[model samples]
Structures are given as structure tokens and as C-alpha cells.
Target: MVDDTSLTSLPKCCLSVVIPCFNEVERIQQCIDRVLEQPVVGEV
Candidate 1:
């Protein structure tokens, strides 16, 4: 799981997968520079 370390380090996350459900499609997309829903994924 990503934590404060991720922000501090500015890590590079991946989104190379195949989702089946349509409801959570937006959760993932083209992993550009910044991660897509960083705020959506609440803090631990």
C-alpha cells in the first residue's frame, strides 16, 4: 500500500492490467506522470 513515503519519493505506479467490472473502470487508466486518483484513495 502507498503511504506518505510515496508522496515524498514521488514513486512511479503502474496500471498495466485488465479490469472486468465496469463500475470501477475509472479507478485505473493510462498511468502517465502523476497517479490518477491519489486523493480518491484515502489515507491509511
Candidate 2:
């Protein structure tokens, strides 16, 4: 198995979050807004 120490030293990279939704218009905005609030999230 891989060691956890090695993973911690890895360089940071851009993150992409994909939210596939159907008939979620009412709460989609809220979900996107919460994701955007995260410091590591560049886009939603």
C-alpha cells in the first residue's frame, strides 16, 4: 500500500468539481455557492 507521508508532500493542483444534477434548479444555486466559498475551489 502507498504511504500517507508521500501524499502529504505532493504539490497542489487545480481542482475541478462536477455536480451532475437533474431537476435541481431550486437548490443548484445554493450548492454552487457553498462550493465557491471553499478556498481551494477555483470554479464550480
Candidate 3:
């Protein structure tokens, strides 16, 4: 188990989100936008 404080202490934009979608032209942008909105999301 990991401590919550350890997770929160990390710098911003330290996380990268990966989304695998096939034939998702319409929803891909929306998904990417949401993922990028996160403070911890460095890249999508």
C-alpha cells in the first residue's frame, strides 16, 4: 500500500494518460480534453 501524502507530494503534470480507441473520431477529442484537464496529466 502507498501513502496518500506521497502521491499528493508529486509535482504537477507528472502523469501520462494513455487511451486506446479504435474508430473513435467523434469521442476521441472529448476523451483527450477530459484527460488533459487533470492537474497531474502531463501528456495524453
| Clash count of each predicted structure | 0, 0, 0
lDDT accuracy of residue 34 in candidate 3: 89
What lDDT does the true structure give each of the candidates? Answer: 0.46, 0.86, 0.78
List ranges where model 3 is wrong by over 4 Å. Answer: 1-14
Q: How accurate is candidate 1 locally (lDDT)?
A: 0.46
Please provide, for model 2 over 1-44, each residue's C-alpha lDDT reduced to its tens digit, 9 standing for 90 to 100: 87999999999888888887799989989989989999998654
What C-alpha lDDT does candidate 3 achieve relative to the native structure?
A: 0.78
* lDDT score, candidate 3, position 16: 50
TM-score of each: 0.19, 0.60, 0.56
lDDT of 3 by residue, 1-44 (tens): 98998998877555556688899998999998988787767554
The per-residue C-alpha lDDT of model 2 at residue 27 equals: 90
Tens-digit lDDT track of model 1 for 1-44: 87886787865554443335457556435432134345443221
- Cα RMSD (Å) per model? 10.6, 4.2, 4.6
Off by over 4 Å in 1: 1-7, 19-44
After the best TM-score superposition of candidate 2, give how far the Cα of residue 40 lies from its true spot, in angstroms: 1.0
